[model samples]
Target: MTTKISSVGLLSPGDMGHSVGKVLVHNGMPVHTCLAGRSERSAQLASAAGLTVNASFEELVQQVDLFLSIVPPARATGVAQQIADAVKTTGTTLIYLDCNAISPETTREVGRIVEASGVTFIDGGIIGAPPKVDGAVPRIYVSGPDADQATILNNHGLDVRPIGDVIGHASGVKMCYAALTKGLTALGTELMVAAEAMGLTGSLREEFELSQSAMLEHLEKSVPGMPPKAYRWVGEMEEIAKTFDDVGLTPKMLLGAADMYTLVGQTPLANETPETRTRGKTLQDVVEILNEALPKGK
Candidate 1:
């Protein structure tokens, strides 16, 4: 039997969620979101993306064919619980996809929560940035006993791929990938901030330019855009750390990375969103802020 997906209910349209909702809407699918307590920016994104706003979760669950949960890692399980309770109460059986950066353990926990309510649970992990109409669409890798249900999104402006017939495969991939990418961002921030504290920013940059140019350039490009996102990454880093420890490997590195993101998240710079980020921000500026807030030998 083919799993039919014609209507999608997106939870709280943030930057990434709004973009995903836009692709669904553009593909002729009816996408809806609840805007009850969302920010003004969230409302603007949903409106711009052509997503229908539901007055409440009950209304959203009653109408949609599928539910896509795209949120921060810290809120992933909580959101799943709310959706499961809503579906159980309304007697609505919907396919729920969790597309957050979380550990496999967390993904399976969410699966058990919704599946117990007779809702089909699909573990989904999104890799890459949001989809652009004329550009690339991020790969949404899904896995579970009912993972094939997610293939309904294929040809609808999303690259939907199934990794295996297990709940955590997709989330495992996300955990490992972010452990390296975001972990490197944390590493770079620490190194640069230490250099700034030692009054060696210039000398360090010159040395890295000659010996580690590729890494230095990557840091320069990525660090400036990370502070505003650091708050969300804190939970993601903790999830990654858990993923590692669950498998019997050392998780100290990512645990330290989580601490680094915590510091970044507390800075005034974290208030800037991608739409309202500081103009001409640089890596040096990021280092100076961290150096001032968390000096060496502290």
Candidate 2:
């Protein structure tokens, strides 16, 4: 059944949310929003976009046909439970789309809460920053017991795709890919930071300029994806811990990497912090090696 979405209820709209909500309204979907843990700015932003901002989260859930949970990972499950409980009384088939960065386990838990209350759940993850309000196309990873939800999202100018099986697979892919890509991001940052501290930053920058700069290039483009992604990484790290417990290997190193990424990600230059730090670390490490190789700094 095509759920003709005449109205869209946006919960916890941030920068990405504000932009996307505007896009929805522009696409003929009257957007209503609610602020749970959002600020006055968020409220104002939503109001300017012709969206009706409600006072509480519960109000948002009850009024909207489809609920989009775009909060931090730690808050995703709690919010889902709260909304699911309220919807149980209404006996409405609420289609809840989870677009938070979380583990497969958490996603399954969210599914349990919503599905238990007879609500439709779509396991989904957003992969990029918000696109242009008009003709915006951000890649979305969506999977669930219901395929219709995915189709509905796709038809609405969203780049939505199924992740297969249950909701867990979608979240799992997000967690795994984030760990590796963000891990190296932190590593490069650490190296650059250390090098600059030792006055070898210039040489290292030159080395990167001549040698492998792909890492540097990738870092440059990916930094902005960190702000929205960092808070979620903390939760994914815990999930990685659980994954390690299942296997024989210890997650000591991975855990440390997770910590490192979180620290820089929360900073102002998170967009530039990692790369700047990496430049320093590389110069220092390389300078030391070169000095030793050249017989006591010749």
Candidate 3:
């Protein structure tokens, strides 16, 4: 049976969520969200994305056919419980998609929460950047019994890929992928900061330029772009750590990465949003800022 999705509900329109809502609206799907108690920036992003703001959570649950939860990793389970409660209170049915960065264990917990309320739960993991007008479109990998139902979004400005009929497959994919991309970013940040602290940054850059040019280039871009997003990545790294531990692998590396992000989150640079983070344009600038904030030697 095909699910007729006339309207879609997005939780809070942050960086990725707003762009997704924009794409859905452009593709002629009516996207709606409840901005009650959300940040001012969220309201601005939602308005810019052309999403209708529901007056209440009950109204939001009652109106949409599908609900996409794209929040921080720490908030994933909480948001799922909120949706389930809303569904129970309003007696409304909607397909619930969990698209946060989380482990398979967390995904199963979310599935159980939503499914217990009689809502169809789809495990989803989004890879790549948010949908842009002229840039690369992200792929939303979905799994579980009704994964095929998400394919309806393929041509609607989303690249929905149904990977399997298991609840955790999609989140597992995200865990492994982020374990590399973000994992490496954390590693690079640590070494670069260490080098800056020891005054070996110049020699390190010279060596990287001669033998590790590609990696140097990657670090230059990634390290500088990390501070604003580091706070969010802290929870994601912890989730990755959990993912690794579940597979009997050492989780220490990713846990260290979580600590690295935690340190970055303490820096003043982490307070800036992507739109307002204009201070660190170069790798050295970011490293210098972070190095200065480091605890002094006793």
Candidate 4:
């Protein structure tokens, strides 16, 4: 039987939310969305984005066949629980889609919640960046009992790929990869900060200058990206570190990565950087920012 997906309701409609809805609407799906608040501005964004603004969560649940969730992991359960509490008994063939960066254990727990409420649950993990404003293709990986529902999302023009007959595998891959890439970037940022603090900054920069270490490239790509994303990555990183720590898989490096990312996350840099809006990597710019914040006596 073809799983029909015509309408999608997105909770917490922000950048990713708006991006996903745009993709869905572009591909002929009717998307009803919500914002951080019921502010008039939020409604305007929804309207400008071509999404029907729902007055309440109940309206979203009652009208949509598929629910695509893209909130943070810590809140993933809360979002699911909120939905389940309201519409779990609706006897509707609703497919609850969770594409947050949560753990397998956490996901299984979410599954239990929806399954208990008689809702069809699908575990989804999004891998690539958000849907394109122009023509970029973002990948969304999904799997679970009715994992095939991911195909419905393809209506949005995403490169949808199924991992296997389960939810955990897709999330597992996403979490670990996030740990490595984001983890490494975090570790690099921290180490760089420390190096600068110790006057080894020049030495390290020389090393990069001498050997052309890829850290520069990483910084060029990572620093700007991490600042805005740090808040979200910190929790996920902690989760990844804990996952490895549970089995004693030597998470020393990853945890450090988490700490570093956590630090940069300390201050959310607006627009990645308003100082040199066009500069590629913060590098010296970031060093100045860090040093100024430090006491001179140290």
Candidate 5:
């Protein structure tokens, strides 16, 4: 029989993490997180989501039956190690779910880390936006031998779908899905900035409207919203590149996308949070800003 999940622990609640916490809270699950040494914004988000802040990882691991790691891709491994250490120190045995946008290789490495402490590790990938109160709900696809253990979340307002019993299946799905969605965004940003640099922004916009209206519309919507999230996406792009390279495909395209996100991260606009970013900025505005922020020549 599967163990009953009574409470949940979320690691470092950021935008997406906080929203997921809120949904679990509203569904009658007590959500907790450790805000020790976290940024003020993270604390604020956790408080807003009704998550109880534990003093440290040790305290957190002891209290919750399930733990979710939803950090950026670059930090996923480190976070797993930390949690594993906490689980060891506290003698706590909880289900660990890694929901970051990392490659299958990275996911397996994390699995080894968490599973080493004798905790059940569930590989998970979140697709779509954060869970909204009334809008579309994001799906958390899980895989691994214990993938069915995550189905408890389905009773608590999340759409937890168990895809397979293989550890990397969920992350592989995520890598391929993001490769298309974010890869296209990178392609659009590059051409828009190039157009701006060549002083042909207006002409390019006209041509796009004449022949590539749908693609143009997608760029207009995606690029303007990218700056705030670009920093995290840099690591995600790199992970996607690694995913492609592992399968014998050239990783150059997504590596270039990583570079594009890194450049965007250097822009002043990248400092804004999702809640505080300017709402009226157009794609042209984003392109011009990126063009102006270009370092040195070329």
Candidate 6:
């Protein structure tokens, strides 16, 4: 049986969530969001994306065919529990998708939460940036017993792919991929800040340009956009650490990466939102700001 998703309920409309909702709405799928405990910024984004705001989670579960949990990785489990509670009480058989950056074990635990209530649980991992209007949509990879149900979202401005019929497949991909991508960002931030402290920023940049040009370019594009998002990535890095450890690899690498993100999240740069980031901000800007914000003891 093919499932048709005519409506979706997006969990807090942050930068990524609102854009995702916009894509669905543009494709003629009605979208709604619960604003009960969200920020004013979230409310603004929801309004801009044309998302109808539901008063509470209770109302949300009853209103949509599916609910997409696109929150920070750390909150994924809690949100799943909340939705599960709502589903159990209402006895509504809706699909619940966990689309956060989490580990395979974590995804299964979330799956257990909703599936117990007779809700269809799909483990999903979103790669790439949020979809841009009239631009590219991010690929949402899903796995689990009910993974194929998510395919209904395809051709509706979302690139939905089914990796397997195992709950953790999608999450494993996300964990491994982000470990490399975000791990490199942390590594670059560390070296750049160290160079700035040693008054060797210029020399290192010149050297990197000569021998590590590709890496340098990646840093230029990735590092500047990291700080404000660093807080959210902290748990994701930890999740990656757990994923590595579970696979018999040493987790120390990503634990260090988690520490690096922790430091970045405390800097003044972390206060800047995606909307408030200066246009055309460069790697030099990020390096200098991090240099000034590095703890005095270090």
Give a tens-digit lDDT track for model 1, residues 249-279: 9989999999999998778777888888873
Global Cα lDDT for candidate 1: 0.89
Using TM-score as the measure, which candidate wins?
3
Per-residue lDDT tens digits for candidate 3, residues 190-254, read 99999999999999999999999999999998888888788889999999999999999999999
Which regions of candidate 2 are displaced past 4 Å? 1-4, 224-232, 236-254, 265-298
- My TM-score estimates for the predictions, one after another, are 0.97, 0.78, 0.98, 0.87, 0.97, 0.96
**RMSD per prediction, one decimal?**
1.4, 6.6, 1.0, 3.1, 1.2, 1.5
Report backbone clashes per prediction. Answer: 0, 18, 0, 0, 0, 0
Considering TM-score, which of the candidate structures 2 and 4 is the better prediction for this target? Answer: 4
Off by over 4 Å in 5: 296-298
Off by over 4 Å in 3: none
Please report the TM-score between candidate 1 and the true structure. Answer: 0.97
Model 5 agreement with the true structure over 274-293: per-residue lDDT tens digits: 88877326788888889988
**All candidates in order of TM-score, best leading:** 3, 5, 1, 6, 4, 2
Candidate 6: regions farther than 4 A off: 278-280
Error of 1 at 151 (Å): 1.4
Residue 142 error, candidate 5, Å? 0.5
What are the Cα lDDT values of the candidates? 0.89, 0.65, 0.92, 0.70, 0.91, 0.88
